[model samples]
Target: MTRQILLLSVMSLWALCGATHVKADHYRLEFPGMDNVLPIASRPANASRIFYAVMFDAGSTGTRIHVYTFIQKQQGELPILDNEMFQSVKPGLSAFADTPEMGGDTVRQLLKVAKRTVPRLEWKRTPVVLRATAGLRLLPEQKAQALLEQVREVFDESPFFVPNNSVSIMDGTNEGILAWVTVNFLTGHLYSDSKNTVGILDLGGGSTQITFLPRSKKTIEAAPADHVAKFDMFNTTYELYTHSYLGNGLKAARLAALGALGAEGLEWQVFSSSCLPRKFREDWSFGGVTYKISGVVDGYTGFKPCYEEMLKVVQGIVHQPQELKGSSVFYAFSYYFDRAVDAGLIDGTQGGMVEVRDFRKRAKEVCNKMSKLRTVSPFLCMDMTYITCLLKEGFGFKESTVLQLTKKVNNVETSWALGATFDHLRNLNIH
Candidate 1:
């Protein structure tokens, strides 16, 4: 009887070991410092293999968290999974100045959900890379350092317990490259072998980045020994040419419209006399320098003329040769002016009013001009309409594959986090 009991115990122990190994084969992980924590359903006990990746795009207006997973294929091709997005509270100027602890709190909350949902999740072995884009990069050095340190501190604790080797804050240029990779991946432009250089233009709420990837011949190149190194997309080795133009989408539209009158543009008195009251004009100034103008309330009644002038300026900037006319522009106008139109905050026909259609037309015209002038067509165009269509139909897998392969040919990395992580995994010989 004693011998029989021992055999039964040994058999039970063997089963437990096999189950642990199986669970480890399908792991869960989160990336960056989170604002929205993502939770996965129970892990599939029979899954062949699984990997997770996360991206945090901290912008001036808000924070976006994207969570994705790669499940090993059983037979045919694996489907590209849909990403889950979590948006943080809309940030104000005060939020930007807040201590990193404030941001850390947000990350902690997000991780709590991840811990509860992902089955047999292992924090130590999983890699989590955190990146802050134009918003934090433009903050004062002292504030930015404090924020980064705070984020690091939060990850050190908790169910996340991210390993020391797993977390990092990418610089602006690298962040821009990642953004490029994500966008291209979604649009289906990533390629494995091509010499096509890509220019990525990202316009966000608080800042804009213009990135240029020069041609190269390698699929992936390591960062240089120097503090700063070049990154290659696919077959193309590329250098980063980026400008963090402060005051992105909203500010850009406002400034462009207001600056139209040139030096002679309306003075405060004229501004007050037009549709806007004195208090409204003053508030619009925010902290920026105000332009002086004549014409009191009486001088500016029936100000339709002023509104028209504003529209003209906005149109000209959008179509300007020196601006985005010839570049492969990827303008994100969704966040901007959403409330304005919805709330009837401004009359679209007013002189200062700018509509989405206006920008779309300008983009179309620029593409047409580039096709004629340079004989090099604008490689890609992303707007609300395109995004909507892609989302509705579920971007066809073939198109996605073609795009990724094309990006590889151009030597540029597709802007997908999974693709980037896959490249990282290959480097580590994990696959």
Candidate 2:
């Protein structure tokens, strides 16, 4: 019952949000007169009523569209999440940094998916928003804004409702918070006073996030001020420990590990690492830039050197939360799950649990046998080692700490998009 009321409240808040453009930089929901909000029972129940929301996840590596359909079975109750239509395209919007219109074209192509998923009659009423993640955040300010302006023009041209500030770069903190909301909400752990909520580790291409409801007050007090956030929902205030580490994402880490992050001379420079197969060399493109990467043919190639190189990227860079070493359930997703799958550490379809040491174990095996594993990605060794180092050293998780690797929950993509959608609706659209 509490969860239901919360969901209804979420719907109310979403409605209020539609009235204006929603900035994704900070999530501070302040609902005035929330105490006197009408009960769901007071409103007319429309069992056949349905609504849809369209969210665009502009990430470092790809751009995705999520179309959510909700059914209001009765008043004063949470609407049923009927289904989601999702699609994605590679080389994310950031790839078009030099060509803003081309980036908008990608969004235009994805909007076709939304057009087909949503009913024609509901087109004008449906809210469409695009939120860029670390990908855009990593770009130059002018370039990022240019890309956003292009997307804004596209949104305005579309039949959907284009709210103000609909296209913008999301704040790293809010990214973590929304993703936490997504996982907890899907797991049925969003109830008031619920202590069973799980923490989330999201490893995107250009950034990463760690968010959880701290069980100890010391966790909050010890954390950096920006690491903690408080928001009101369901008439309850939640203070969560969350932070997004920009430039620490999988792809970005690879660049940093190769010593090619922000360096020039990409055309003549060769970024080499001991993590790759001894003979491996390739031109990799990430976030609209290309880098020449290779393994040191004359140097040693194995886990030790690779782990050492990765250490420079993780050690002392990531914060160590005091409570993380204690008993806490965590869900690791995005690149954490992807790299685990690539390394054959877990089943791709059915995600499973593994300890922090499991990643280390796999990193060793993959790094030691790079020559024999021709079918695997050349960066597999580095990626695995990075995950291992990031977990054990970056965040200071115990080797035995168990992490649930999941790609989806209840058939919906486990990301901040849904949570952002819910937030978008709560603001109430006045049309």
Candidate 3:
């Protein structure tokens, strides 16, 4: 409580006095309320309380952009998140590996959203950046660089301010950390009376990331190399446990569970697995590659066999964090929220909290139904089971562990994009 009051006091001093140098990279876009006020950057700077930043999130499954407007509250105080204009496009940039132009075009289309959201007068001032995640990270080295180069071309063509380091692929460690920052910042945990922070479980299509500040030195010592990160924020130094598994994401794990990984003959023969329905067959596409898949018509099926299969996709591969088993709050986003909504465990409009056993229960229900319900996705059984294993046996979370599943907090999309924008703002000296 003292820390929170002191921090707010510092912010108040900055706001009321004058000159709060916000590092360009760490600036938080905020709007307290600016109906008739001008942005602090405007010529008539009294009303100049708001500034903008445009961020592009090029992920494994989709490309999204967030246009954030921040309010200065006063001349020099740290800004707060007033509002965010967000948009997304499907088939991620990696889908156009063979055609870089089309990949860049997707980015170009997203820019139209930014153009509309950010005022024309502010175009040259708002910094625009694109950061690709696991999807592009998995592409061939040359191919990934080619795709990035094409996207850079699109950024260059935009009217928005382009920072030198604006277009690049974010490392997986930073990905988890940025996401952690975004969630904490949104929850007001970072700037409040409570210093307690929540853990983040982000399951993307091609990768999954878990990040949180550890409570014990044992956790830091037991963690794998590059899994623990140390950084400074708000005059506090923090050591966070974070890691991203590249191929353990929901969609990729489905392919791995099906025994279809690296099977070249998609057109000649179908990959079969017990996780699917006994007679189900279809063409599955991921990361721009198509594979024909089917269930084992002559073999066993149902929850047990399916669970065992999906377990192999995560078990022994994911390292269990010791702190995760103890009492702590976790916020699961991306595919975690999507699957829960699909299973009717929660409403999509308002994501709900659920115990880890909830996933286990739904996995059994869905996989058991697959034998007779050939109408549904054969992979649904595997996907749900994989999610169950990921939280339980994979990460060592207990059955009673509670997870808050959400896509948005206060209307801003819960993602690393906002964190990325804040990180960029931090780079600037805004005193």
Give each prediction's root-mean-square deviation over alpha carbons: 15.2, 6.6, 5.9
Model 2 per-residue lDDT tens digits across residues 130-235:
9999999999999999999999999999999776678889889888988887887777777654557799999999999999989999999999988889766564
Candidate 2 lDDT for residue 144: 97
| CA lDDT of every candidate | 0.38, 0.83, 0.79
Off by over 4 Å in 1: 1-47, 74-82, 92-96, 120-124, 161-170, 194-200, 211-230, 238-242, 249-357, 360-431
- For candidate 3, give the lDDT: 0.79
lDDT of 2: 0.83
TM-score for all models, in order of appearance:
0.51, 0.89, 0.89
- For model 1, the local distance difference test gives 0.38
lDDT over C-alpha atoms for residue 313 of model 1 = 31
